[model samples]
Target chain A: MLLEWILGFVFLIVKLTIVLIILLTVAAYLVWVERKLLGRIQARYGPNRAGEFGLLQPLADLVKLITKEDTVPQEANKGIFLLAPGVVGLMALLIFAVVPFGSGVTLWGRSIPLVITDLNVGLLFILALSSISVYGIALGGWASNSKYSLLGGIRGAAQMISYEVPMGLSLVPVVMLARSFSLVEITNAQSARPFIFVQPVSFILFLIAALAEIKRIPFDLPEAENELGAGYHTEYSGMRFGLFFLGEYITMIILGSLIAVFFLGGWHGPLLPPIIWFLLKVGIIVFTLIWFRATFPRIRYDQLMNTGWKVLIPIALLNIVVTGALVLGTS
Target chain B: MGTIKNLAEGITALLKGLATTLKILSRKPVTEQYPEYRRPLPARSRAVIVLTRDPDGEERCVACYLCSAVCPVSCISMQSAEREDGRRYPRWFRINFARCIYCGLCEEACPTLAIQLTPNFETSGRDILKLVYEKEDLLVNHGGKNNEYNFYKRAGVAMVGDKGTQINEDKPVDLKSNLP
Candidate 1:
């Protein structure tokens, strides 16, 4: 029993270390990807001087963020203000625990699940954790005691909640097809047949809804620079602001991975190993997200909400119903 | 009937919107990668002004200061002096291109056909002083294609003679005779 406990602790540490490395690297590259892709779209050269093709630009940004002085508002809620970004960053990192990087392999004389935990209700767990990220935004805005931040927070909360319905509904067909809340099972089912082929409409709804959830362009109402002056995390500075920035990109990576696993047959391909296939799929999805960001303009708040509640929600419901009927009829 | 028609119209509109997006997605991007592909400037493009000489390589300017006077940006500065042969000439001509708006008005106002706009528009410089074109830098050996036709010779402006030698005036119009 003692040996088992020690082994578990070691495994936990290993998983945590892996998650940390992946999150930091993904977040850093996301900045590079955004600049390079946006530059191409705008007919301008993005950062190409920091390192070879500006690969080290993110590192330079991190150094700048670190060296800068941490500023705090005199009238701000010091406790909540300090804790907000930490909450966001931690929540973003935690969501990666259940993300199956590859199938189980025998390690140290035991079969390991590759994932940190393969909980039966993994999907629900992810949803719950993702929902908790909203608190960080809300808390940041409220603690700042700034009107713009307050408005941003209120808008972010409403937007997130409104989109979550369609986002959740979009996943219903996948769950129905896989017949399990377990991410591993869903991935396994996807190997047999990618869900995108069967549920293209649901995939589209999920992409749009997920983009909204992550507050990307066309749905980036929370931090509308022109409208809200940096939005919920406006007053945040130094490492605190960096943490929020980190959280945002990490969320993008996680969503990209989720999309890959759910619809694009995660880790399933010929010749290349499973991990490589998974990375390739995630990379493609992330590129598509960045492409959309560069190409499209931000939607207005009312329009965003209308699209979510009125348009997406109905379509997602219809998709689920149709998927259900098709599955039943086929079976 | 109206509700059903509205629904059909909405569906058609949505499909049309989707089709447009798909068309754009399939088409090649319209972006022109500049620096690699330079665009051709139009014939009448007013990029920069240059001073021109006659075919005989004589300076066409008579130091009239018309270009300087008409310059909107006040970029042109020149001093006029009479030569030993009693011919007007510019002693020093300078144009601070940094301040010049390249409006082509100076070219239009040069009565002597000395100034003309050129096609060379890429004039960016690291230093402001480098942009200031002196007389030597602005002067060109050939009269620009259109300015080859001398305005002074064609307009009956006498250069060396009194009123009787002026062209097209019929010996000062014989003002005492009023001939039919």
Candidate 2:
């Protein structure tokens, strides 16, 4: 029994190591992807010389960030200021735990699920953790003691809260259809058919809400450079700033994964391994997000709020109603 | 009854919004894969300037300071000197491209058939000093590549003994003519 526990602990460490490496790598490459996609959209070459089409651009960025000095405000809460970025980064990493990368497979005389945890309340866990991410932004902003940062914090918190409603409501149909909160079970439910066909409106609402949740373009009012000057984490420098950047992209990845699992049919395809299909779907979704960033201009703050409450929330509710009716009619 | 219809209208508007988004998704992306595809620039693209010689192998410029005086960046610097045969020529003309705005004002200001803007705008360099163009660097053997008509001839400027000669304009109006 002791040996089994020791082996389990060892396995857990190995899984965590792999997850950390994968998340960091994905976050770095997402930055590259954004630049390249934006470049294509704007008719210019973006970072193609750092190393073989700028693959090493992220490495250069990482090095630059590390070498830079870490500065804290003199008249601010020192402990909270230091802790905020760590909180954000940890929360971002934690969301990936419930995300099922692939079906369980035997390896080295041991069966292991590709995800860290297959929690029963995975969706709620993700929502709760994501909400917690807002505190990091708020604390960082407040700790900076600057009016811009304070304003940015207020905007970010409000935006996150406002958008979270539609975002949660949009997922109701997916949960209703799957009849399980477990991400593994949800993946299994999607094995035969993707949720997109049955819940198109929910899927659309989810995409928009997820984009807003991630604080991407068209909904990036908090970080509006023209007005707020780099937003809530404006005064953050070095690895602190890097942490926020990392957290943002990781959130994007998590959202993409969620979308893939919920709508695009997680790990369900012919003539390919489950993991490959899952990754391919997630990749396509991430690329679409980048494409949106490239193509669309930022929306105004009032317009963004209007879109959440007046547009997305009602549509999400209607989708749930319609989906329920269709399911009942078919039954 | 009107409120129910209003709700239906709102749903239609939402459908329209989705349709618009679907249209965008279906259409071919306006994105240009830049490294693979080069954009075509116009013939009169404001780029760099180059000095040129005439077809007869004679320098087009006669130590004219029009280009220098008109340069907005003051990049153009030149000194005029007389040759043994009393012919005036630029001893040393240089343009510090580092300071140049590429406004093409110098080309416009040149009275002589000397400076002309070309479509070769790709002039990036690591060294600032390398951007400075000397007389030899600016001088081109061919006459203004784009300008078919020589400016000196077009302006009807007297060149040495070729005064009051060539093309429309009866004998330079014989300064003292009263036949108006």
Interface DockQ of each model: 0.06, 0.06
Candidate 2 per-residue C-alpha lDDT over A191-258 given as tens digits, one digit per residue, 9 for 90 to 100? 88898987888898998998988899868888889999988988899999999999989988888899
Q: What's the CA error at residue A225 for candidate 1, in Å?
A: 0.9
Per-residue alpha-carbon lDDT of candidate 1 for residues A160-219, written as tens digits (9 for 90 to 100) = 888888989999999999999999999999887899998899898999998999899879
Q: What is the interface RMSD of candidate 1, in Å?
A: 5.5
The alpha-carbon deviation from the true structure for residue A210 of candidate 1, after best TM-score superposition, in angstroms, is 1.0
Candidate topping TM-score = 2
Worst 10 residues of 2 chain A by lDDT: A36-45
- Cα lDDT for residue B2, model 1? 100
In candidate 2 the C-alpha lDDT for residue A269 amounts to 87
